[model samples]
Target chain A: MGDLLRRCLMKRTDPDAPQKRRRGAAVALWGVMALLVLWALFNLRAIGDAFVQFHAFLAYRFIRRALIVGMLVSLCASLLGVTLVLKRYSMIGDGLSHVGFGALTVAMALGFVTSEGLPAFLPQGLRGAVARLCAGIAANPLPFTLVIVVVCAFLLLRISEHSRMRGDSAIALISTSALAVGVIVTSMTSGMNVDVYNYMFGSILAMSTSDVYVSVTLSAVVLVLFALFYPRIFAVTFDEMFARATGVRAGGYNMLIALLTAMTVVVGMRMMGTLLISSLIIFPALSSMRLFSSFRAVTISSAIISVACFALGMLLSCVYSLPTGAGIVAINLVVFIAFSAIDATR
Target chain B: MALIAIQDVTIAFEGTVAVDRVSFEVARGDYLVIVGENGSGKSTLMRAMLGLVKPRSGRIVYGDGLEKNRIGYLPQQTAAQRDFPASVEEVVLSGCVNRMGTRFFYNRADREKALGNMKLLDVERLRKKSYRTLSGGQQQRALLARALCATDAMLLLDEPVTGLDPNAAAEFYEVIRSLNRDHGVTVVMVSHDLSGAMRDAGKVLVMNRGMDFFGSLEDYRTRFAEGMVKGHG
Candidate 1:
């Protein structure tokens, strides 16, 4: 037992062993990948026909918008997920999504009240400003929800860092309260209850043009920032303390991550619903992690996996009339399991 | 002048003092080893020097080329940290982040420095390998190579050999000794391996929540010899 342990723990002095094994594994993996690609090529006609059927639907414009937004959101979420999951802050996504739900509920309620009730206590200018802001939110709830989610994300990070509260406890406290507030706000608003429910369960067909525009613009910003600061983010994710010691400004990078995560969560809520959106952030990264070791490889592979999963899920939802959010999460689960099994065999 | 001067520094966590009124100076090319039992604040003192922990009172002043973010650091690692999804090259290259300044990307010079340091640490072969898959000693060497990429002036290691087997620990010590003796890089290491540290260190700082002794290794041995024997007995 002792000898076996020693042999396993010690460095392999035979340098050629690892190289030969790695070469063999690489060849096998590439062969399997080529076969899969060939199979996909053979089914191209069937796949094209399925997409043609999808385009024939009257609500295809909204579905198309949802697909674009979903793919962008998935890419951003998976990129950010690698850092967050490794840092043990995966639950921050769940907490912030709940906060977004509350924000959406409050925004809708305020929009309803501003349009219906004349709020006699306010002055003319104040009322005009409030009415304009409420009108903007009524047109698209994402901006309002983005503000609240960003604030909550910052607060969550601060509380977890400075206070005695652990990350899990903080996430629980914030999420439960936000969920309660959302429920209360939804109950209070009578006419817009359906809209709140739509946001809660996600209706791709209900996404407005403005929502798609906002999602694309914000997601592009996230992707650009992520690319620009890739080195710093890598340093921060791996060893925050050492990054700080090396003058990486780890706090700034952390704040950037939280902000990007908030944007992804808020934007994704339109397609995946607030309740299920975090799965988009958690699943793809975890799935890719099972098969990849390096940070770059895992991040890129996760992004690809996320986009593929979203596309498949959207197809499944369109064909079976299932909830888009749940469909995407289900596909992600299947992919995660498959990847885990493959990793176990290795 | 000393490369770093700690004048009555105190470090606290949430208003509770972890290190109290500790003063020390590290001259250029000096190998200063800080030895103490657990909870003795050796790590805290090192953190203060690196500016990772703010001194609750007093100040740490730098002289010559030594400044904040100009020293290499190898922090203590946990199991989760060891499993970070990064290649050895990526990990080593990140040490150049401070030198990149306002630049967002690493330049050719930074890559060259990283490569040179990896070669220096004998980890150039494992450059493309995943860091998590490396053995304990190899991981430490990779991390040490990362630290070397940060600066040529000094290195501040926090309990660098905590989990290594006896042979690996000895090998690690020799590598550190070479860096100090041959490469002329000053080292301030926090360690529990008092005897191993004393073998290479020019100065020794013993602590128990505060500075118990600070002097040459011979002086430490002579001053604490009786107490050590008594404790052993």
Candidate 2:
């Protein structure tokens, strides 16, 4: 029950603990990660031969991308989530995902080719037709990506700022708006029928090489940045006024985090879609909460959770003919429920 | 030389003045203790000194030529910070973050200093422990250790000894006294314990809405709060 959680969630810094225990916990979490990959690998036969053959070469490379991207995203999210959760802004992840959706919609309308391949949703003819429509919107994809992100970011900032509204509320409200706009815009455009559903649920099997490239690159950048600013972010998270008084530039750092979140949201949308992006960010964190104590531990554990969940999710969706996006979230929900029950027991 | 000088500082929230026209001066290592009832602008005055809020009027001048990272601060237990995931050691190490001016690993010397400071505060044994696991008094010590890492100059404690038992509170007060007398770290503590803290304080500032009374400890003992004609309720 809570015992397992207590062991992992609040255990980060015990000045008195032996280093051996910490290392042991780290290894066990990694072991869990390895087992999950092996499980997924054993069952990857369901991934429809054509797509897997053309894009997903040997088992190692395909698994590596999923594992690497999932872990990296989870690690970054966990590092930021503790602060966000403690600061009571945990809902921002959800809101940002909707903004990502709106960006995707605008990206679609404007026709930008980021080399991330075409959308995997809809019939092949429809994919080309939508591409043509997007092409008609603008010749360049980058500016399309840029404009939607900026607009959504601006709107989100206003909502969170003006009312001093609770962050979760802001996230829920904005995401609903962005998501509704996504539905309305896609519907009005015609011929893009499958687009919203695909985004809503996600298709990990359809994850393009370019999608992995974009997400992983963004993840790497976030990792490096967080590493460098660890102390500053740490101070701000613990005691903002103290951080500010000690010359940590808490305000600047908070703003930077908001910007990073925006980017993470935008890039991550390609995989999880707007509706489920926050799950990718949140579930791994919630799952890892049962096993790690320190901030570093939580970060590491979350990465493990993300990798395991994603690999399992892909296999489960293919076998059950389930929606990939919903399947991932459902698996995480089940895991969370199971853990909460055990936690209550403790 | 006076370390703190304030003139006509007024702070308000949504049209109600928390501190009104407060003015006071404190000499170096003077150990000026502020006494007030709850919501009596004591905390607001302290926040004003820390620049958390801008005052509506007047100015606050520091004779010590304040450095950005020079002041040590201990805030009351804020809900905003109760669940931060830092280890006690890492929490203390944040004191060195600003001082690290250039980027890279925190030089070994800085880390050593932080460890020593934590040791001084007696929370060294909890250094590897999570900041949130420690009890109230221990948490305050951990915070003090963090503050000590920031500067060797002035120390500001806002109701730091509140949740402690009498003995622990006395010990906490003694540490403040030692910091002032031995380390020459100037102390400005906001407290409701007027009688107890008057022992070591060189000066006392009674703040109602603002600085209602300011005098030497001897003067305060002679005539408590002199006159409370203008005070905030």
Candidate 3:
């Protein structure tokens, strides 16, 4: 066992490999990037027409929104993913998505915004004013879901830090519990409805205009915060204790990471679905890590890959009439495999 | 005044005490090596001085124009860092984060400072390489250069040579010795190597959950080293 472990660990460092493979990796990277740019250049008119003709046969209106929101969400996810995945907090995205699902289901069931699940079990006295007061929020369940997921993110951080429970277990506990509640609420109120199915599997058509607005605004906030605190985030992620000793406010940066991740997960869950949203957070970062050595290289490439994957996935889904979420995930997997192959050859 | 003065500082986690009523002082240009067996609170005391841990009762005073945040620290490596995807330059440059002070990105000055330190540690050639790809000695040099970027006046190293081979450990010690003797940096190192660590230190602090001996290295060698070895061996 010890020999096996040592052998596995010894493979991590090969002094000659990096120096020899640098040129090849760079060539492959630029070749792919140039190909993508050329494709975009050639398809510029079709892309522009999609915007002008929203009701076109492909339902370009929904595709346009999904592409915009998907690109932003994935950009934010991949950027944050590099840090979180390094810190082993990648599953926080999965946990938060499950929590978002639970919050959405409960809100719908309580008659917050949906008429279909109108608090049938509520007492007569409490139902009228509660319904009226929450009616405004019902129109957009995003704010409610955002608030809940953000709070849960903070709680998960706290639990992982202070409690004796390990991080993975804490995540598993919260995620499973939330998912169960969502399923129970669904069964209790409206049974297995199309809305519930859409939330689970993610349909590009499920995103409303207001959801797009929220996504754009939140994604902008995420991007700005990430840019401003990039160095501190790197410091904190690399070595928390060292950063703390050097007065980097490690706790504050940790909370910031959690907060940004929560926002991304909530916004992304609308299009990617609770079940598959974490792929947006995990796949790009992992794929980029295979080929890039520097943090900057990995991060920039991850963002570009995420946005490109999302765009290509949307195109495939539009042409083949495939499920948008599955198509994106499949594309991400293919990219990951390709990158791994590149790494192996090098 | 002393660079740092620990007055009866006791550190505890939860209910159990890790360090009990430990007192010591490190003056400017002092090379203080703290030695102890495993779980003897040497590291806890060092952490308390770094302000990573708060004392249960006593005070840790920093004087001699030493800001709490400006002290360079070379901490033990964590598992996460083993596979961290960052260039050597990026890893070293992050040490300038505390000094950046509201600046979002590293400026030209920060880059120059990082490069100068890398040159000092003889790691400038490896700047563009991946950090994880370096050998153990090279990694240590990179981390030491990172520490130098934070401050030239003082350093706090916690078991910096723990996993290094004998040659790498000796080379690291020589680098630190030069930093102290030639550059006049105050160093507080918590190490397990007694005789080897004592060769370069001006002061020796023996810790067993508290201060067992705190004095000049000559006194520790002449009066306390034999008894300590006998007691702990």
The candidate that achieves the highest TM-score relative to the unseen native structure: 1
Residue A251 displacement in candidate 3 (angstroms): 1.0
- Error in Å for residue A95 of model 3: 0.7
DockQ for all models, in order? 0.76, 0.55, 0.80
**Could you give candidate 2's per-residue lDDT for residues B1-233 as a string of tens digits?**
56777878999988999999988876676788888888889988988887777888888877767663677888887786665656788888878876788774577878998999988889999888887778877888888888888877788888888778888788888878888899888899998776667779998888779666788877776664455343411
Model 1: per-residue Cα lDDT over A245-344, one tens digit each: 9888888888989999999998888679888999988998899888888999999998999999998889878876889999999989878766765665
CA error at residue A148 for candidate 1, angstroms:
0.9
Kindly report which residue pairs in candidate 1 clash with one another.
none
- lDDT for A156 in candidate 2 is 63
Q: Give interface RMSD, every candidate, in order.
A: 0.9, 2.0, 0.7
lDDT of 2 by residue, A37-117 (tens): 687687677445534543343265654565455555555665566566655666777787776666667656554442235
TM-scores for all predictions: 0.89, 0.78, 0.88
| TM-score-sorted candidate list, best first | 1, 3, 2
In candidate 3, the residue pairs with backbone N, CA or C atoms under 3 Å apart (3 or more residues apart, or in different chains) clash, namely A112-A138, A113-A138
CA lDDT of every candidate? 0.86, 0.70, 0.86
- Over the stretch B1-233, how does candidate 1's per-residue lDDT look in tens digits? 98999999988898788999998899999999888878888888889899988899999999987878989999998656777778899999999998998998999999999999999999999998999899999999999998998988999999999899999999999999999999999999998877777788899888787888889988877877767533211
In candidate 1, stretches whose alpha carbon ends up further than 4 angstroms from where it belongs are A1-52, A55-59, A112-136, A191-193, B228-233
* Displacement of the residue A161 alpha carbon in candidate 3, Å: 1.9
